[model samples]
Target: MASKLILLEGVPCTGKTSGARFVASQLRGWHKNVRLFTQESPTNPVDLMNYAFLTPEQYREFPEEDRVLFPVEETENPKGYMIPLTELHESLQKELESYRFYGCQPWEVERPLMLARWRAFAKEAMESDAVWVLDGMFFQNPVCEMMMWFDLPQAEIESFMSELADIIRPLEPLIIYLESDQIERRLREVADQHDYEWLDSLIAFHTGQSAKPNEVPDLEGCVLCLEARQLVEKKLMSKLGLDRVILKNAFTDWVEAYNFIRARVYEKTMGKPSTDK
Candidate 1:
């Protein structure tokens, strides 16, 4: 069967968002039902970026009126009932932000919760004809959590990703990795483009981890960390046992990149080469 899932992954400044959108557009042109889910998209099926996960006990403690105000999704995990943290009013969000899953939970708790979502998504996706263009779900966000937030060992990270690969294997998902040749220069470019505050926050996020002495003290350190991350991501991509392509980050010629990706995605889903000119 043809693949329904297309995953775009890379380190920062690698244009994953654009790649995802382009892939979705190309698939749509082919008359496929495409759903593009960027990394920050709140409606991403396989990831809960701004959602809060609460145990049954914690959820029950919420005021009865509040419980009925917003939507919540029940999960197989006894502890994981999800509510939208961003959708709630500011005051209410403040009260529950601590329960947010991404940065708030430890890896031990987060690993299963995240995998469960992937499993469910894979199963449900098989039932639909809609093609899903997902940016960052396969590697970027998960790697960030495992490496920076939790300081997990490399083996654990690989294991977690391996399990995800297995769950989605039936879909024969196509993985597109944007490869960056100039890590430091690209990071500096990103820093220059964004506000100092954003860069500062990112630096803090990388340095303020379990490791000591602020290893990622500045932009240079950030670049090093990203380089290391790219190595691991490439390693995983090489051995994922799935159909994939590594596209060099095309800063100067996005039209070329878009064409290349579109052709790859088309071949994967159509079970043959694309004849687009």
Candidate 2:
């Protein structure tokens, strides 16, 4: 089968969001139904980015006044109810955000939920003709949890990835890793583009998750942490043994990068290079 699941992955400021948009546009141009899910997308089928997961008992006990304000989804296999954080009032969300399944929970609790979600997603993808473009769900998000949050060993992380690979193998997923050789420069550029608060928050989140927070005190330390992360991610990508491509981008010429990515996606999905461009 041709690839229906296209994953664009990389660290911050690597143009993953732009790559995803380009890939989806290219697929749509080919008359294919394409769904582009960026990292911040609330309705991503595979990852629980901004949603709060609650047990059945907790769901029942949730305040009726607050619960009636928004839609709720119940999953049987995972045996939980999901409520979007955006739907809840600020005070209520603050109280429940820790229950989020992605970054807030430990890997042991998050692993099964991740696997189950992927299984369900793969089944649905098999039934549809639409192509799904995910910005960071495949490697980036999982890597953040395994490497930064949990500090798991490479072998253990590989085992977790292997299970996910098995579930999505039927979809013929393609992983496109966008990377820059100048990690520090890239991070600084991103930092320059954003406000001080954004950079401060980013450094805090990454450093605060570190085993030795004192070691990563500033941007220089954060750069080292990102360098380590990118290395691990690339290593894992090579081990996945799936159809994958690594694009070296400087983020200077996005048009050129888009052309290359579009061609690669064409080759993977249609078994030929794109002729349109």
Candidate 3:
């Protein structure tokens, strides 16, 4: 049983994955149940939308069907999420794939189906008794990816975020934003740590600077795209107006960050001040 939805979001190497694992363990230590969802984890039933975009590894295997367009990660039945795309209404299949990927705007044909999917996710998560820890679903997936793909304006981003906020309000998510003080140092570290040979793909995916994956784009372009994205994310996060904890230098100060979140979750779940505080 999940009591709350805690979404972890930040730039690369900002301890999102590590901190998510840490927080989940902390919750468990408190005699609370928690479920962790991350991209690196096995495919979930609701993973349809996430795999719509190619990961770094999947991009390297490009020209494969459904890489960028209508991407689908193979998954066995009885998935952890327990909600399969096959169960969706037959009419929504085509648009569901596009909407899952944010392929169209909210006012377009995919709007209703897209909103339905968001509602479905939030509803299920809200009803769960365990605290669910998810990386990137609330903020990163739609905000950054859609902005980079469509070159959307701030107004458009704000509106879309508003709709999303309203849909998930029932779950009462506490967003733990993993931020870094030394942005450039962290950027370089993430790039180097992965032994990344897919700079062009990374750049193109994040910024939409290249038309196709084959085109080699310079690092400068990617840096600029990253910088621009940071601003947009900051604005959108503020607009989201959910319960938030911004952990500056989260990479080094994760213990403090985790303690803060532990208190918040305890308060929400127990409906009182946490003994942790």
Candidate 4:
């Protein structure tokens, strides 16, 4: 089978990570080369502090460029090169207080630069021989050769849909939307993990924004919900669709999800066992 690029897009708090993991496990079981990349970096407080320095309205109105980078300064310290001392100090205090809780060094506060780094990473992944399973809120960008949209409730996505559309347009890959109920349940399940509080907040905020009507752009690809997976199969019969893609119920336990994916892999590989074993 030809190499496939699967992008799983969803608001924060939605179960994209779990779903992506399931997909990756299934692909590996089928003996297809697969690599799963999820966004795991912590948000830098310096970046947030700088942005927050502006008046709330001003911050909201600031040009994307201004919001992304600091102004250049002639001093050797450089204007934007280092995180603001005050912000860094405050962040350090928080890190020290929550050192055990945080479990990682605080992220350096920088904007678009980090995003650029991630883009480079994705480019490298695309160049590899393995099937790529990217899970995140990567709005449809030119960098993405193919795309998938996880449809969730408008209440769940809030403003993120608009923000995402502004960066990327008309993705040219299969778009899969988990029904709203499933998406919500997944978020709740993730929130149950005590250590995932930050992730939970991020998801809740985004999902709330996505709920706004007309926020999400019209994407160019197949749209599948939890129930629609069956329909997708019927629609793609005889076509070289995502043979690697599998349908999973939102309510199903993780084990069932694993089995569902494994079954699809078995079908695709004609019962060939995964070589990884």
Best by lDDT: 1
**lDDT for each residue of candidate 2 in 56-112, tens digit (9 for 90 to 100):** 887777688866864677776567777788777888888787788776766765787
lDDT, model 1, position 75: 74
**Better-scoring candidate (lDDT), 1 or 4:** 1
Computed on alpha carbons, the lDDT of every model, listed in order, comes to: 0.82, 0.80, 0.62, 0.38
Q: How does candidate 3 fare on TM-score?
A: 0.71
lDDT of 3 at 226: 61
Task: Give the alpha carbon lDDT tens digit for every residue of 1-277 in model 4.
Answer: 4334555544434456666677777778667787676554233211221212222343345456544543321212112332232334454434323221111212222224334434444455446666666665343221111111234334323233333332222222233323233543444465466444443333333232223222222110111222243233233322323223434454356566555545544444344444432
The parts of candidate 1 lying over 4 Å away from their true place are: 209-216
Top-scoring candidate (TM-score): 1
List the candidates ranked by lDDT, beginning with the highest.
1, 2, 3, 4
Q: Compared with the true structure, what per-residue lDDT tens digits does model 1 show for residues 70-140? A: 57888776565888776788888888888988888777778888888898999889989898889988887
Tens-digit lDDT track for model 3 on 82-143?
A: 12345444543453454344443333423344455677777777676777788766666566
Score candidate 2 by TM-score against the native: 0.88
